[model samples]
Target: MPRERILELRHRGRSFREIARETGCGYGTVRRAYWGAGACAAATERSG
Candidate 1:
């Protein structure tokens, strides 16, 4: 459920700072997840 936890934090509008604190995830990890999601969406749009 690690990915689900990340999405929940995202939906709650938690800052990367807050998510890091709450989830004990590194800042880079949280930020990477966020940006990676955006990149996936962008790639999808380009392909479509």
Candidate 2:
């Protein structure tokens, strides 16, 4: 759920700090979630 929310915020062009504040998570946590999602998407595209 947190990951999805992070992604949603990122898609809306929210900064990491903004996401962290809105999600009640640390900035690094939000940043990592975004990077993790991007990595997963890249892997999926490559595999598909």
Candidate 3:
């Protein structure tokens, strides 16, 4: 799944379960992807 789509859906107030259903991915995958994006963004902010 595209990261942008995941972020967009999340931004629209979709839950991880909803995102997983919409994207045809597992709930854990959706949660991890969302959290991983946050972690990466935080790392980028810290680095740059």
Candidate 4:
């Protein structure tokens, strides 16, 4: 699944469970992907 799409859904106030259902992924996977994307973006911002 696209990370940006997941992030967008999350930003739009979708819960991890909701995103998982929509994206056909596990709830844990959705949560991890969202947090991982956030971590990566934060790292990039700090580094840049």
Off by over 4 Å in 1: 35-48
Q: How far is candidate 2 from the true structure (C-alpha RMSD, Å)?
A: 8.9
lDDT of 2 by residue, 2-45 (tens): 46656787789999898666656667766777777432333233
Summed over model 2, clashes come to 0
lDDT tens string, model 1, 1-48? 145556777898878788766655567777776765422233233436
Winner by lDDT: 4
Candidate 2 weakest lDDT stretch, 10 residues:
38-47
* Candidate 4 segments whose C-alpha is farther than 4 A from its true place: 37-48
Please identify model 3 stretches exceeding 4 Å from their true place.
37-48
Query: Over the full model, what C-alpha lDDT does candidate 4 score relative to the true structure?
Result: 0.68
lDDT of 3: 0.66
TM-score of each: 0.55, 0.61, 0.66, 0.69
Q: Per-model C-alpha lDDT, please?
A: 0.60, 0.62, 0.66, 0.68
Across 1-48, the per-residue lDDT of candidate 4 in tens digits comes to: 656767898889999888777666778777777877432333234435
Better of 1 and 3 by TM-score: 3
| Deviation in Å, model 4, residue 39 alpha carbon | 13
Most TM-score-accurate candidate:
4
lDDT at 16 for candidate 4?
Answer: 84
